[model samples]
Target: MAKDHYSVLGVQRTAKPDEIQRAYRKLARKYHPDVNREPDAADKFKEIGEAYNTLSDPETRARYDRFGSDYRHYASSGAGPGGNGGRWGPRAGARPGRGGYGNVEVDMGGDVDWEDLLGGWFRQQAGGPAQGTDHEAELWLTLEEAVRGGKRTVRLAQPDGATSNYVVDVPPGVLDGQRIRLAGQGGPGREGGPQGDLLLTMRIQPDSRYRLKGRDIYVDLPVTPSEAALGAKIKTQAPAGTVTITVPSSSSSGRRLRLRGQGMPNPRGLPGNLYAEIKIMVPPSLSKEERKLYEKIGSVSDFNPREER
Candidate 1:
């Protein structure tokens, strides 16, 4: 049997939100695919990511808890109460051709967000007859979701007295602010003009363990004071899971370790580095004897941080 996500992260079933996040970060750093190079590391990272995505959000988590993994099937099939599966609009009709593909349809209400629906229309009008207006929207993803791309259904209100739902594929390496185009998904063709396109931008959900800067990823890792004093290979975590990094002895807090080509990959096919910022931590609840020992050894070195200034 597959390990439970909660178990993989080493958290209790009732762990608080922050606790769950902390656990995930710690584990992610330890097993990240780039760092470990393990055969199944990528798959493990993806599994944890899916679990976190489902459990992290209140609404989505509630649905999952109520209906389990199969809840999505129920949601899409309009199997839930209230006729329309509590969706924004109507269920899709038959798919087109063969085994029923491209046959799904949605009826968006007339009072739908005009800007969302007609932004492309106005933009097209600006340039002569305008090629079909292109639609744009943001897609929020978790770290794991980005690694293992899949389909997502989003609901939109229409100009008619109805709603419309679209199934979109979230491809891998789709970074934040990146756009995915759906051909001919724009406003109706004007006077025999070709249909426009729909542009969907991506925004990954924030993770407490990982921070992205452009294509590079940064993470703060905790290290013991002793480990910093006596350089060691410290295991750390990332969105892809965990990896071990060498920490030269005599390292200090705020030191950075680099993992080449481990950061986000861009459209140009260039991958960025992964930076691990070290934060040395002391025991918060030290006993009196431990404090005395520290004081005895305090004056061993003369290091001044502000000397450079």
Candidate 2:
């Protein structure tokens, strides 16, 4: 039995176009083969797309609603929805020929082209070129590469044990999960039709030194105890290059210093800010002179960090 389109999309039969579209998008995101690894996820995703394609269109929805499961069969048979037939059976006055079903007269009212009917429904033309299918692939980029956009060579494996290389132009400040489209670079069209597009989903590789949150970047800045106690200018790493930053006096761990416009560069708008989180480091082993100096300072100072706030 053909699955019900409404049931496949988990939407009511009376769902509006926007409601159906929303359900399709939600299900598609959950069941997309690229994101979901379950064995049946690909099938479920395809089913959802099919349901959306049918229900989203007013004409297709009307046909499906009238003919139920046999809509395609009835439509391709040159029988209108109001034809003198029950579902997909023959007309009321039709007589069974030899073998009880050999000859059946279908009142098409005029000369009908079966090929044209089926082809039109499937978005194809008889003896004509057809557009190719669009393709999607993931493109992984390092944090540095994402920050500074450039041309990258992408190698895609074909089904026939061959590979094709394409140079992709990545724009700066492209967020993770964003898509870049390459026009007419997908599967070849049939009979010289226009080729489809290739969509590349961006996947930013993780970096140990930094963490990204939207356009903002967070990085741990290791500072000596002396530097923290007394304000000092220090050099640190940024996405583009090393930059000198100022450390405030008496700064503690976890204190963030903001460097405006030092993060991911945005070609469209304002650049992101880079935050340097302070992490004070102490000497592993102190020499005799250092120990004496610390002891002297400890004796002179009456400050107690363990005191109640």
Candidate 3:
């Protein structure tokens, strides 16, 4: 049997929200497809992600606790009341042809798709032409791709039991949870009605280079001792390309340098800014001359960084 949400997250059923989040972050970092090379890393990551999403939301978590995974929507549609299945069919005098609706019967005795079952009942009660239900799926993009916008291809399982491919035209400045719509790409309409849409929700993959907040980006800008001491112009990675920016003299770690309009671009309006934080680094190994020079400077200078401490 498959693992439950708590099992997947390595948490108890009574785990607190913060505890759940902590466990999720630890597992995500370890199993993330981009980070782990294990054969099952991608699948495990997806499973944990689904587990975290379900457990993090109170309403959904309650629903899951009550009815298991199918409780998502299926169980709710099961035999509305008193276990009498449901009332679903075309209305009387309704046209049945190419120009109008048609008859598509099913044997709901053994097994059936509850999603389709619910849709049919809804359509019959509406007493009018109804479009198919919209489908939702997630699309993961790299940090660079989310900023630049490009063609991303996705393969989905069609209603007819076949997988089809589509090239999504991702827009620039896309962020996590942003929805992109694809018209008439979802479930097929019944009785010649128009098809529904497919919606793709964007999720920028976790990047080690930068952190994102809305439109702005934060990145670590490493500098050598000389560069931080005397100031220097250094080339660094930006959302768009490599750009040179100057660091002020006597800079310290955690100092932020802003690059205006160098962040995610907007298709409609002004772009966001990128903030580079200074991180001074020293060479791990030193040559004889380099060691001598450092010793001399130490003897000549009376700088005490630990005075405050």
lDDT of 3 by residue, 1-309 (tens): 657989999999888878987897788667766557898877787787778767765444655665576646533223322324442333322456632224543335434545454656643543445465465567889989999998899875432324578789999899889999999986566456788788888989999998988789888999998799899999998868898889999898999999999988878888889999999998999999989988997999888878985
Tell me the TM-score of each prediction against the true structure. 0.51, 0.62, 0.61
Per-residue CA lDDT of model 1 for 171-213, tens digit only, reads: 7557878787878875555446787776677879999888888
Model 2 accuracy (lDDT, Cα)? 0.75
Clashing pairs in 2: none
Quick one: best lDDT, which candidate? 2
Q: In order, what lDDT does every prediction score?
A: 0.63, 0.75, 0.74
> Judged by lDDT against the true structure, how good is candidate 3?
0.74
Q: Write the per-residue lDDT of candidate 2 for residues 1-309, one digit (tens) a residue.
A: 889999998989878888987787688667766567898876787777678767765545766876787666554333554433323323222235512222453343444454355435333312246566565678899998999899999876442324578899999888899999999997677558888788899999999999999989999999998899898999988887898999999898999999999988888899999999999998999999999999998999887879986
Between 1 and 3, whose lDDT is larger? 3
Against the correct fold, how does model 3 do in TM-score? 0.61
